[model samples]
Each structure stands twice: as structure tokens, then as C-alpha cells.
Target: MILENEIGLSSFRNERQKASISILYTYGFLANCYEQFYKMHGMTNQQYNALRILRDQYPKPVSTSFLREKMLDKMSDASRLVSRLSAKGLVVVTQNPTDKRLVNILISETGHQLISDIDSDLYKLDDLMNGITEEEAVQLTSLLYKVRNSLKSTYDNTVTEEQVHA
Candidate 1:
């Protein structure tokens, strides 16, 4: 179905605007699915993401800064996520010995078990894309990369306050 039919919109300014809105709407749809899935396990998406990162890192502790950079939503508060996860006993936060001001986090045993339980659910969620062929998915990925790269070039060239100061 066309975006118009999907959203009940009469029209968009052009194909470019339509495509942009389509991406955003599709993202919202996917996010809603993820939220519901995560909620069933008693964790928000951000908390799940944090636990996943820590689980992936395993024995190694990761800094809040690293989590911030790796999170799906970069604008979210990593410190707050750690605090919540800590309360849930899903992770352990420790002060960095070398830098007392910095904190590092690792997934706890409960977190690992939680992830193990949810891993299958996450895979099943991906199976929803089985409606599309592998080739179609690859083409969609390529197009998204092209769109992002085009925007990245423009963003990377823009001057920032830190860059100006440096």
C-alpha cells in the first residue's frame, strides 16, 4: 500500500518528502513492536539495549560513554539507564579505578539469563521481514545507506562550536 493509503494523507509535497515521512512512520511502527516485546519481559527498550551491550561485551566493562555511542537512541541518558538497570539487578556499575570520576558497567548473571530468554523472541521478531525476499532486503539496506551517507556528507562538512574553538 502507498504511504497515502497507509496514513490516510491526501498527498505529500513530492517523492522526497514522501519517502522521508515513510521512513519515519515505518520506524515508529517498528519501535512500537519492539516496545511491546520488551515490555513483556519487564524492561524498556533502552534498558534492554543496555543489557544487550553489556552482555555482548561479556567479561569486559564498558563505560557509559561507550553505551551512549552504541545505543539505538543516541539522545537517551546512559547514566539514567545504568541507574535503572542497576536497580533491577540486571547490571553492576563500578567506579573506574584509573578514573574515579568515570563509571563502568557489566551485565550481571540475571541479565545474562534474561538475554538468553529474550534472544529467541528477538529472532522471531526479525522473521516478520520474511515477507520480503533476501534480495529486496539487501536493496532496501543499500538505499538506506545511500540516503544516510548523502546526509552524512552535508552534516560532516558543517562547522560546529567545538571545531571552531579548536
Candidate 2:
């Protein structure tokens, strides 16, 4: 598919610019696709991601701050998400006894069941990427990692400068 036509854009300044836009567009499009699938299961993508993280932690209680660090949607309000999940009876939230200021969250039995119920569907959706050969998928993943790694030095420099100013 043509990125220009898909995004209703006629041109880009260069291939790099086009590629950058294409990657963003593809990410949003795929996220929308996942959103639609999860909608039928009565959850949003961010909610699902939070549940997945909590499930990974299992019986262990996690703080919103920790969830925030691990979330794919960094903009998500982790506290709000946890509240919503609690309301749905998918998670248990409690104040840490040792520290009133600290709150903890854990996935409940209902949450585990919900995850089990949705696992097959999620696995099938993930297989959509199977259109590409295994080797191609590996190469694509590596290239994406490389692209991000290439920007690390620039980010480090900016971070250090900001720290100095602060």
C-alpha cells in the first residue's frame, strides 16, 4: 500500500521523512486494529497492556510508578487505569500497610480468567504479522532496534544537558 495515498499526503521532503511518517502511520493503524479487537472484549489497548503487566507480576503487588515505566503507551494515566480495572473487579488495589503513601495493585482471579479467555484471540491477532517470513520479521525487528540505538547518543547528550540546567 502507498503511504502517501493512505495518509492523504502528496509528498515528502525526502525518503527519510517519508519513512518516518510511514512508521508513525503504521503504528497508529495497527493500534487501531488492536483497539477494535479489544473493544469486543470490553477493554482498551492501554487497559489490556496494564493488565498484562500486572499478570506478569502475578501475586506481587505493583505500584503505578512501576507500571508507568513498563507501559507501551507512556502517556497513559496508570492510577486511573488501575482504578478502572478495580471497578471492573479485575484487580485489587490496596494501600501498603508499611507506608500509607504507597498504593499497590494486583490482578485478581477474575483478571486471570479474563486473560485466559482472551489469550487465543490475542495470539491469533499477533499472527497477522506472519504474512512476513520469519527471517524478514527478525530483520525488521533488528533494524527498528538499530534505528532507536542510533538515537541513544543524541538523547543521552540532551538528557545530560537538561540535568546540568536542573
Candidate 3:
């Protein structure tokens, strides 16, 4: 389906506007797919993301701040996620021995089991990109990186200007 038709818009202001809208729309579509996939496993995408990070770093506890830095969703409250996972017995949280102000988090056996279960069906999630070839996927990734780099400079300039004005 055409993007304009899908969005119910006759046209965009220009190619740039169309591209931006397309990216956002595509992201929403993909996010919805991911949400459904994770929900089937009784977890939210953020929770799964945190678990995956913990799994990768298994046996070595990590801080909530580390999870926040590594999470795909910057808006997620890592501490809250850790608390929720703790409540579900999916993770273990403990006060840092050296730094009482900080807490260490590790995936529990239940968490590891859940992750393994999800991994068995992980190919379904990867299939979401079946519309694109491997080469196109690589190209798309590169393009997104370029876009982020450009946006980073723009964001930095805006923040600098705001600070200066303040």
C-alpha cells in the first residue's frame, strides 16, 4: 500500500516530509508487531530488552543505570522495570556491596527460562523484515545511522543555543 493512502494523506510537503513520516509510520508498525510478540510471552518489550541485556551479562550483575544506557527505549525507567521484574520473580535485585546507593540486578532462573522460550520463536520477529532483502536491510541500517548522526548535531546545536539564551 502506498504511504499516502495508508496515512490517509493526499500528499506531503516534500520528499523530506514524506521520508520522515514514512520512517515514523514504519516504526509504529514494527513496534506494534514487537508488542504483540512480547505480549504473547507475558512480557512487555522493555522488560524483554532488559532481560536480554542481563542474559548477555549473566553471572555479572548490572546496575539500573547500565540498563537505562543500553535500553532501546530511552524513555523507559530502568529502576521501575527492575522492580517489576523483581516482583515477577524474573529478576533479582540487591543493594550494591560497595555502593549502597546503587542496586545490582541479575536475571533469575525464571527470567533465563523465559528468554530461552522466546528465543525458540525469535525467528518470527526477524521475519518481520522479510519484505526487504539482506542487502536492503543493511542499506536501511546505514541510512538510519546517517539520519541519527545528522539529528545529533541538530539536537546539540539546539541545546547549546537554549543554554546560551538561558
What lDDT does candidate 3 reach at residue 128?
Answer: 100
Each model's TM-score? 0.90, 0.90, 0.95
Tens digits of lDDT, candidate 2, 1-166: 3888888888899998897788888788788889898898999989889999999998899999999999998899998999999999999999988989989999999999998788868876777687799899899899888878867787999999999999
Tell me the tens digit of each residue's lDDT in model 3 across 19-124. 9999999999999999999999999999999999999999999999999999999999998999999999999999999999999999999999999999999999
Go through the candidates in order and give the clash count of each: 0, 0, 0
The lDDT of each candidate is 0.90, 0.89, 0.96
Candidate 2 wrongly placed segments (more than 4 Å): none
Off by over 4 Å in 3: none
Question: What lDDT, from 0 to 1, does candidate 1 have?
Answer: 0.90
Any idea how many clashes model 3 has? 0
CA lDDT, candidate 2, residue 59 = 83
Badly placed stretches (over 4 Å) of model 1 are 160-166
Ten-residue region with minimum lDDT total, candidate 3? 1-10
